[model samples]
Target: MKPLELYLHIPFCIQKCNYCDFLSAPSCAGERKVYVESLCQKIRSYKDLAKAYHVVSIFVGGGTPSLLLSKQIEQIFEAVRETFVIDSDAEISLEANPGTVTEEKLQAYRNCGINRLSIGLQSAKDRELKRLGRIHTYEEFLWTYELARKAGFLNINVDLMSGIPLQTLVDWEETLHEVARLKPEHISAYSLIVEEGTPFYERYGNGKHLEELPDEETERKMYYRTREILESYGYHRYEISNYARLGYECRHNLGYWNRTEYLGIGTGAASLIREERWNEGEIPEKLDRKAQMEETMFLGLRTMKGVSKAEFAKTYQRTMESVYGKVLEEMQKKGLLLVGEDQVCLTDAGIDVSNYVMSEFLL
Candidate 1:
C-alpha cells in the first residue's frame, strides 16, 4: 500500500491574530461541539480511500486545535483510526497555541496518540506578543511548554515570527535566543507577511505603516540571523524556514515538499492525491508533466537538500538537465545555486530571493 499523510484543520481559535489569513474564527462551545461531530463524519467518509494507503503521519492543525476539549480531539482521532490503516509508528502532531493548552489536555493528547506538540509562541517578548495581538503572553507560553514536557511529549516544535510593526533586530534576536534556550526538537521561524485580507494588511500593506515595521535591510538581517543563531544552538536548517535537531524534522510537512500523497479533511483543507490537487468538495485538477516538474523543483528546492537528480529522473523519466538545464546554468553562474553531481540546491543568497528563483522554474 502507498504511504499517505493526513491533515485535519480545526478552524476555531480563541481570537484571530492580526496577521493571520487562514480559515479560522472565534467559536463558542456549542459551535465547537457541532464542528467536532462534522469533522468526525468527514473522517469516517474516507474509509474506502484508506484501504489503499497506510497513514504515515497525521497533523491536527489550526486556527487553534488545542482550543477543542481533549475529548473532542480524542473523538477526531478515534474516527481516523477506525477509518484508516494507520502506521504503528506514525508521527501524530497537534498544533497548540500557548495559552490554550493545559496539563490535562496535554495528557489527553498523549493518551490519544499525539506524540508531537507544536506551540505557537510567535515572540518571547510581551510587548512584541501584544503588538501581534497574540492571545498568549510569553509567560503563558513557558507554562504550556513545561506542561507538554511533563506530559511526556518529547518531540516539540516552537513557532516564531519576525518583522512585526515596532519590532527591531534586537527584538527578533531576543525571541530566537529565548526559544533556542528552551531546546525544542524543532523550530519554524517565518517572516511576517501582511497578507491581503488580514488586519495587518489594512494597516501596513503599503508604505503607510512602513516606518513602524522593519525596513527591508533589517528584515533581511533578521532572516540571516535566524539561520546563524539556530545553527549555533545545534539546530540544523533543513528548510528555508524550518530548523530541527537531528531526526526531528516534521514528517507531515516533508510529505508536502516531497510531493507525497495526502488527504486533507475538514473545512477549507486541500489535498493532493494521485497527481491531482483539490480543495474540499471540489473537482480535482490533474497535473500535467510540466506542472509536476515545476512543483518538484520549487518545492524540493525549499530544503537545504534540494532536488535529487536520480529521483527526479526516476519520477519524470527525463534528466533534470533536459528540463531546467538553462535556468540552472544561469543561476549557478550568478552564484544563486549550487549544482552538485547528485543534487541541485540554492545558495544562501538564492534562499533570500527564493520566490523569484522558484518562479523561474515555472514553465
Candidate 2:
C-alpha cells in the first residue's frame, strides 16, 4: 500500500500576529462553531480520496489549532479515522500556541491520540515577544510546557525565532540555552522574514531597522551557534530549521522534505500525490522538476541528508556530476556543498545562503 501523510489547517486565531501572512482570521467566539462546521464539510468531501493509502502521519496546523475546543478536536480526529486507514503507530501532531494550552486541554489531546505537539514559543524574552506581537509571555509558555508534560506528551517540539528585530547573537544563545533546559524532543529554529503586506513591512521596512536584529553575517553565526548547541544536547539537525532527538524526528515534516505523497486539506493548503504537485492547482513545471527528479533534487537539498547520487542516476539515467558538472564543481570549491559517497548535502555556508543555492538548481 502507498504511504500517505495528511495535513489539516485550522485557520482561526484569537488574534492575528502582525508579521503573519498565513490564511488565518481573528476568532470571533460566535463564529467559531460555523467555521468548525465548514472545516468538517471540507474533510468529508475529501475523505474518499484517502481510503486506500496507509496513513503514516496526520498533522493539524494553523493560526492556532489549540483554539479549537476539545470537542472540536475530537470531531476532526473521528472524521480522519473514518476516512483513512491510519496506521496503529501513526505520528499524529497538533500545533498549539502557548497562550491557549491548558492542563485539561493537553490531557484531552492525549486522549484523542495526538502523539506529538508542536508549540509556538517564539522567544523567551518578553520584550522580543512583544516586538513580534506574540500573544504569550515566556512564563506562560513554561506553564504550558509543564502542563503538557504532566498530561503525558512524550514528544513535543518548540518553535523559536532567531532574526527578530532587536534580537542579538547573545539573545539567540540565551534562547537556545533556555530551551535546552526544557528538553523537548524537537526544536525548529527559524529566522525572521519580512514578507510584503505585513504590518512590519509597512512600519519598519524602509526607514528605521532595529539595531538588535543582527545583519547577514550575524544571522549566519546565530544559525551555526544554534546548531552546535542543540547538537550537544543530542538533537540532530535533520533539516535546515529543525532539530530532533535520535528517534523523535517529525515524520510529518520529513514526508514533505522527502517529496513523499501527501494530502493537504484546508483553504490554501498544498498537496502532492502520484507525482503531481498541487497548491490550489498544479505547480508550474518551471517551478519544479519534470516529475520525480524535480522533487528529488529540490526537496533533497532542504535536509541535512541531501540527495543521493546513485538515486539520482537511477532515476535520470545520468550521474548528477555529469549532468551539472560545472555548477557542482563551482559550489564545492566555494564550500557550499559537500559531496559524499551516496548523497550530497548543503554545508553550513550553503544552508545560510540556501536561497541562492536553491536558485542554482532551477536552471
Candidate 3:
C-alpha cells in the first residue's frame, strides 16, 4: 500500500479575525455537534480506500480546532482510527489558538494520539494582536504553550506573520525573537497578503493602507531576514516560509509540496488521489501528463530541495532537460534558479519573486 495524508477541517471559530478569510465562522453548541457528526461520517466513508493506502499524517486544521470539546475531539479521532490504517509514527497535528485550549483538552489530545500542536500566535505584541482581531493576548499564547509542553507535547509549532499594518521592521524582529526564545519545534512565518472580502480589504484593500503598512523596502527586509533570524536560533528553512529543527518538519504539508496523494475531508476541502483531483462538491478531473508536469514543477519548487530531475524523468519517461532546458538556463543566468546535477531549486532572490519565477514553468 502507498502512503496517504488526511486533513480534517473544523469550520467553527469563536470569532473570526479581521485579516483572516479562511472558511470558518462562529457557531453554537448544537451547530458544532451537527458538524462533528457529519465530519465523522465522511471519515467512515473512506474505509475501503484506507485498505489501499496507509495514513502517514493527519492534520486537523480549523477555525480553531481547539475550540471543540474534548469529547468531540476524541469522537473525531475514533472515527479516523477505525476507518484508516495509520502508520505507527504518523504525524497527527491539530491547529489551535490561545484562550480556547485547556489542560483537560491538552491531555485529551495526547490520549487521542495527537503528536503535534500548532499554536496560532500571529504577533507577540498585544497591540499588534489587537489590530489583527485575534482574541487572545500574547500572555494567553504563552500560557497555552507552557500548558502544551507540560502535557508532554514534544512537537509544537508556532505560527507567526510579518508585514501587517502598523508593524515596523523592529517590531517584526522582536516578534521573531520573542517566539524564538520559547524554541518551538517548528515555525511558520508568513507575510500577510491583503486577501479580499475580509475586514482588512475594507480598510486597506485596492491600493489602501499605504501609510499604515510597511513600505516595500521594509517588506523586502522582513522576507530576507526571517531566514537569518530563525537560523540564528537553530532552525533551518525547509520551505519558503516554514522553519524547523532537524527532523520536525510538518509531514502533512510536505506531502502537499511533494504532490503525495492526500484526502482532504470536510467542508470545502480538496482532494488529490491517483492523479485525479477534485474539491468537496466538484467532479474529479484526471490530471493529464502536461498538467501533472506543471503541478510537479510549481508545487515542488516551494520547498528548499525543489524538484528532482531523475525522479521527474522516471515518472514521465522523458528527460527533464529536454522539457525545460531553456527555462533552466535562463533562470540560472539570472541567478534566480540553482540547477544542481540532481535537483533544481529557487535561489533566495527567486523565492522573493516566486510568483513570477513559478509562472514561467507553465506549458
Candidate 4:
C-alpha cells in the first residue's frame, strides 16, 4: 500500500478573517454539529479505502478546528480511528486558534490522541492582528501556548505572518524575537498574499491608501533576517516557510511536497492521485505528465531540500539530466537552482521568483 495522509477541513469560525479566502463560515454551534456529522458520513463511506492504506498522518485544519466542542473533536478522531488504519505513531495534528482553545479543549485533544498542535498566531502585534481580522490578541496567544504545555503538548508550531500593511522591519524583528522566546518546537512564517475579494484586495482596488506592503527588497531582507534569527534559536529551515528543531518538520506537508498521494476532505480541498480523475473545481484540464511535472517542481521548491534527483528519476523513469538537461543548465547559469549529489534545491533567488520557474515545467 502507498503511504497516505488525511486532511479534514473544519469550516466554522467565530468570524471570517478579512484576508482569508478559504471556505469557512461564521461559527454556529448547530451548523458545526451538522458538519461533523457530514464529515463522519464521508469517512464511513471511504472506510474500505482507509482500511486498505497505511495512514502516516492526519491533519485537522480549517475555519476553526479549535472551535469544535471537546466532544465533537473526540468524535471526529474516533471516526477516523474506526475507519482508518492509522499508524501507531502517526502525527495527528489539529490547527487551533488562540482564543478558541481552553485548557479543557487542549486536554481533550491529548486524550483523543492528537500529538501535534499548530496554533494560528498570525502577528505578535495587536494592531496588525486587528488588521488581519485575527480574533486573538498577543496575550491570548501566550496564554494558549502555556495551556498547551500544561496539556502535555510539547511539539507545538506557531503560525506567523510578515509583510502586512503597516508592518516595518522593527515590527518584524520584534515579532520574531517574541515568538522565539516562547521556544516553540516549530514555526511557520508566511508572507501575506492578497487574494481577490479579501478586504485588502477590495481596499486596494478602491484606492484607499492603506500602509504600503514592504517592497520586494524589504521583503527579502525580512526573510533573511528571520532565517538568521530563527537559526540562532536552534531552528533549522526545513521548508521555505517552516522552521523546526530536528525531526519536528511537518510530516503531512512533506507528503505534499514529495508529490505523494493523500486524501483531502471538506469543501474546496485539492488532491493528487496516481490515476488522475476528473474534478472540476481547481484542477487544471488535460492532466498529464507535464501537469504532474509542474506540480512536482512547484511543490519541491516550497521545501528547503527542493527535489531529490534520484526520486525524480525513479518517479519519471528517466535520469534527471535526460529529463531536464537544458532547463537545469540554464537555471544553473542563472544561479536559480543548485543541483546537488542527491537533490536539486532552489537558491534564494529561485525561491523568490518560484512561480516563473515552475511555469516552465507546465509545458
Candidate 5:
C-alpha cells in the first residue's frame, strides 16, 4: 500500500499569542466538544480512501491540542483507527503548550497511542514570553516538560523562537541553553517572522517598533548561535531551522519536504494526493508537471540531506542535470550549492540566504 500521513488540526487555544497567525482562537468547552465531534465525523468520511494507503504518521497540531480533555483526544483517535489503516509503528505527535497540559492528560495521550509530544515553549525568558503574549511563564513550561517526561514520553520536541521586541542575543542564547540541557529529542528553533494579520505586524510590519526588535545582523547571529549551541548539546541540523539527535528527526515534517501524500482534516487544513492540492473552502488545484517539479526542488532542498538525483529522475523521467544544469552550475560557482554525484543541497552560506538559493530552482 502507498504510504500516507494524516494531519488533524485542532483550532482551539486558551489564548492567542501576539505573534501567532495560525487558524486557532480561544474556545469554550461546548465549542470544543462540538468541533471534536465534527472532526471525527470528517475522519469517518475518508474510509474509502484509506483503503488505498496505510498511514505512516499522524500530527495533531495547532491552537494547542492539549487544551482538549483527554477523552476528547481518545474519541478523535478512535474514529481515525476505525476509518484508517494505521501502521503499527506510526509516529503519532500532538502539539501542546505550557500551562495547558496535566499528568492525567499526558497519560491519556499515551494510552490513546500518542507517542510524541511537541511542546511550545517559545522562550525561556518570562519577559519575552509575556511580550509575545504567551499565556504561560518559563516556570510553567518547565513544569510541563518534567511532567511529560514523568508520563513516559520518550520522544519530545521543544519549540523555541528568536527575535522578539526587546529580545537580545544574550536572551536568545539563554533560551537555547536552558531548553537543550533538558535534552528533548528534537528542537525546532524558528526565527520570528512578523506575519500579516498578527499583532506583531501592527507593531513591526510598518516599521513602527522595528527599533525594539533585533537588528538584521543580530538576528543572523542568533540563527548561527542556535546551531552552535544545539550542536554542542548533541543535536544535528537536519533541516534549515530544526535540530535533532540522530534518528529523532520529525518524520511528519520530513514527509512534507519529501513530497509524501497526506490528508489534512480541520477548519482550514490542506491535503495533497496524486499531485493535486486541496484546501478547505477552495477548489482543488491539480499540480501540473511544471508546478510539481518546482515543489520537488524547493521543498526537497530545505533539508541538509538535500534531494537525491536518482529519485528525481525516477519520478520525473528527466535527468536532474537536464533540468537544472545551468542553475546548478551558477550556484556551484557562487559556493551556494553542493552538487554530489547522488544528491544536491545547499551549503552553510547558501542556507544563510536559502530563500534566494531555492528560488534559483523555480523551473
Candidate 6:
C-alpha cells in the first residue's frame, strides 16, 4: 500500500475572520453535532480507498476543529482507524482557535491521540486581532498556548500574519518578538493577501484602503525581517513562509508541496490522488506529464530546499536539463535561481517575486 496523508475539514466556526475565504460559518451546538455525524459518515465511506494506502499523517483543519467536543473528534478518528492502517507515529494535528479552547477540552484532545495543536493567533496585538475579525485576543491566545503545553502537547504551531490595514513596521516587529519569546515548535508567518469575496476585500480591495496599508517596501522589509528574527531564535526557514525548530516542520503540508498523494475530506476540500486533482465529491482532472513537471517545479521551489535534479530525472526518465535547461539558465543569469549540483532552488530575490518566477515553469 502507498503511504498517504489525510486532511479532514471541519466547516464550523464561532465566527469567520474578515480575511478568510475558506468554507466555514458560525454554527450552533445542534448544527455542530449534525456536521460531526456527516463527517464521520464521510470518513467511513472512504474504506475502499483507505485499503490501498497507509496513513502517515492526519491534519484536522477547519473553521475551528477545536470547537468540536472531544467525543466528536474521537468519533472521526475512530472511523479513520477502522478504515486505514495508520502509522504508529503518524502526526495527528488539530487546528484550534484560542477563544474556543479550554483546559479540559485540550486535555481531551491529547487523550484522543491528537499529538499536535496549531493555534491561530494572527497578531500579537489585540487591536490587530479585533481589526481582523478574530474572536480571540493576544492574552486569550497565551492562555490557550499555556493550556496546550500543560496538556502535554510539545508539538505546537502558532500562526502569525503580516500586512494589515493600519499596521506598521514596528507593530509587525513587536508581534514577531512576542511570539518568538514563547518559543513554539513551529511558526507560520504569512503575508496578508486581500483575496476577493471576503469582508477585507470589500473594505480594502482595488486600492480602496491602500493608505492604511504599509507600502510595498515596508511589506518587503517585514518579510525579510521575519526570516532574520525567527532564524535568530533557533527557527529555520524550511519553506518561504514556514519556520520551524529541527524535526518540527509540518509533515502534512510538506506532503502537499512534494506532490505526495493525499486524501482531503469534508466540505470544499481538495485532494491530489496520483496525478489527478479534484475537489471533494468531484471527478479528478488527470494531469499529463508536462503538467506534472510544471507543478513539481512550482510547488517545490516554494521551499528553501527547492527541486531535486536526480529525483526529477528518475521520475520523468529525462534529464532536468532537457526540460528546464533554458529556463534555469535565464533565471540563474538574473540571479533569481541557484543551480546547485543536486538541486535547483530560488534565491532570496526570487522568493520575493516567486509568483512570476514560478510562472516561468508552466508548460
lDDT of each: 0.93, 0.85, 0.94, 0.85, 0.94, 0.92
What is the alpha-carbon lDDT for the whole of candidate 1? 0.93
For all predicted structures, in order, the TM-scores are 0.99, 0.93, 0.99, 0.95, 0.99, 0.98
Supply candidate 1's per-residue lDDT for 3.
96
Tell me the spans in candidate 4 whose CA falls farther than 4 Å from its real position. Answer: 206-211, 277-287
Number of backbone-clashing residue pairs for each candidate, in the order shown: 0, 1, 0, 0, 0, 0
Candidate 3: stretches off by over 4 Å: none
Model 4, range 111-172, lDDT digits (tens) per residue? 98999999999889999999889898999999999999988997999999998888998899
Give the lDDT of residue 103 in candidate 2: 78
Better of 1 and 6 by lDDT: 1
In model 4, the Cα lDDT at residue 151 comes to 88
TM-score (C-alpha) between model 6 and the true structure: 0.98
RMSD versus native structure for model 3: 0.8
Q: Residue 361 lDDT in model 4?
A: 56
What tens-digit string does per-residue lDDT give for candidate 2 at 191-270? Answer: 88877788877766765565645787898889889989999888999999999999998999988888778888776778
> What is residue 285's positional error in candidate 2, in angstroms?
8.2
Candidate 5 Cα misplacement greater than 4 A, ranges: none
**Error of model 1, residue 273, in angstroms:** 0.5
Write model 3 residue lDDT over 1-363, tens digit each, in one string: 999999999999999899999999999999999999999998999989889999999999989899999999999999999999999999999998999999999999999999999999999999999999999999999999999999999999999999888999999999999999899999999999888989999999888757999989999999888888999999999999999999999999999998999999999888999999997878999999999999999999999999999999999998889999899999999999999999999998899899888899898
| Cα lDDT of model 6 by residue, 177-283, tens digit | 99999999999999999889999999989879689888999999999899999989999999989999999999998988999999999988899887889989788
| Model 6 residue pairs with clashes | none
Question: Where's the lowest-lDDT run of ten residues in candidate 1?
Answer: 204-213
Decoy 2 TM-score against native: 0.93
Report RMSD for candidate 2.
2.2
